[model samples]
Target: TQLLEQSPQFLSIQEGENLTVYCNSSSVFSSLQWYRQEPGEGPVLLVTVVTGGEVKKLKRLTFQFGDARKDSSLHITAAQPGDTGLYLCAGGFGSYQLTFGKGTKLSVIP
Candidate 1:
């Protein structure tokens, strides 16, 4: 079984601050995806990292895959109140199913 652990499960920051959340696992994954969810809505895919050491950026958000493919991180710059939400990392394993982390809940106070 594959399990993913996310660190600093809860985060509270003022608007315009920065934050980083992490995900780690002992199992190797074919791909990793990041998602953001708001109240009463399903998570929205933010980015997908495949190759080791790959990095993707979307506006103020950045995503990175570990060199060994066993971990990933998400960094947000100058966060806004609108950025407050639940962030999740999902790993794709051999069975083509995704094993998700507990998720990081972020609160950006304006």
Candidate 2:
């Protein structure tokens, strides 16, 4: 089974800090999706990039898909307390089930 692996399983930062989270895999995917999940709530979609080397930005967060489609990265510029959550990256297509990384939990303290 294919899977996504995330680095730095946990992170703690004060408000207005910057951080980067990584996701990796051995298989290529047609598309990739990034989601941010809060405690006791379903993950909310942040962005979906279909093409390799695609980059998308939301507010202070930037997401990039590796040119090989085997990895991705999330870079946050000047993160705020609201950015604290579980950052998840998922890749797959159809109903085959979306594979999610172990997740990077970010805590931005005020």
Candidate 3:
């Protein structure tokens, strides 16, 4: 099974600061997806990277897939309090189930 490990399980920052979080796995995957979950809601899909070394940006957020497709990173620029949530990374290996990371909890203080 491919297990994704996330760094700095918890993060706290003041609003307008920038932060970067990472997800890594020892096994390679066919595709990787990033998600964010709020208090009482299911995770919302943020982005999906299928090609190695692919980079995608969503406003102030940027995502990149590793060259070998075994890792990914998310960077938030000038973060706001609304950006607080649990970030998760899931890897697909052509199976019905996806291997998911434990997630990184973030709190942006206003």
Candidate 4:
């Protein structure tokens, strides 16, 4: 199984600031997914990138997959306090094996 490594283990920013978090791995993944978890809830899927060089945008957030399918990133524009959460990146290997990163804990101050 390939392991995903996330950068900037923790981030604290003021409202309306823009920031980006990255997920990287040495091995290529068939597919990669990004999730967001709140204080006491399960992680929620934000976007899944199956194709290399693909980009998806959700509202003020942008998701991108590396051309080699070995990395990914999430960028938040004009971030708000509600955006505070733990950002996780998962790499899909075989049938259902998923390797997750340690996640970046983001604290958006209002």
Candidate 5:
């Protein structure tokens, strides 16, 4: 029942650097998810955190959900040019519908 908000609406970094993005909300959620999308393609789900304080990692990418279930974060290590994309955070409230944040656009330059 909460709306997610993402920070750093836009980001640009050089390859091999690390970066982190955040999503926050005032209302609690049952679950939260992170996704990555390219310009012409649909978003690809990266991770889902249902339990508070949960942390998931995919290679060099790490995702974490806050203990209060009202916030989340994503971190990328040694970012590469291919890592450039739109990062989205969505929260679910035990239903099929999901409330998404204003996606963070990332640009990794070589």
Candidate 6:
């Protein structure tokens, strides 16, 4: 069975702190997507890195796809209260069903 395992499922940090979340799997993936969700709202796509060793940055956030395409990473710099949310990683092709990670809940305090 395809599965994505995420680490440090819960995180709380003060404003201006840095944090990193990880997604790992034994199966190789074609692509992976990162999403952030708030209460009462669906997850919003943060980024998708298809190629191996690819890295994309959004503001203070950075996403990296593993060389084997079976793992990924997210790093946030100078986190703010607005960053508090649930972070999810999905692995698979868009045309196919994606397997989601357990999710990481982040809380950024002011």
Candidate 2 pairs with clashing backbones? none
Candidate 4 residue pairs that clash = none
Q: Which ten residues in a row have the lowest lDDT in candidate 3?
A: 91-100
- The C-alpha lDDT values of all candidates are 0.95, 0.90, 0.94, 0.95, 0.94, 0.94
lDDT of 1 by residue, 12-91 (tens): 99999999999999999899999999989999999988899999999999999999999999999999999999999999
Q: Residue 9 deviation, candidate 3, in Å?
A: 0.3
For model 3, what is the error of residue 41's alpha carbon versus the real structure, in angstroms, after optimal superposition? 0.9
1-110 in candidate 5: lDDT tens per residue?
Answer: 46788999999999999999999999888899999999999999999999999999999999999999999999999999999999999998777779999899999999
Error of 1 at 21 (Å): 0.2
Q: Where does candidate 6 stray beyond 4 Å?
A: 93-95
lDDT of 3 by residue, 1-110 (tens): 76889977999999999999999988888899999999999999999999999999999999999999989999999999999999999998875659889999999999
**Which parts of model 2 have CA positions greater than 4 angstroms off?**
93-96
- Summarize candidate 4's per-residue lDDT along 8-96 as a digit string, tens digits: 99999999999999999999888999999998999999999899999999999999999999999999999999999999999988668
Q: Candidate 1 has what TM-score? A: 0.97
Regions of candidate 5 where Cα sits further than 4 Å from its true position: none
Clashing pairs in 6: none
Cα distance off (Å), candidate 1, residue 109 = 0.4
Hey, what RMSD does candidate 5 come out at?
A: 1.0
Worst 10 residues of 2 by lDDT: 91-100
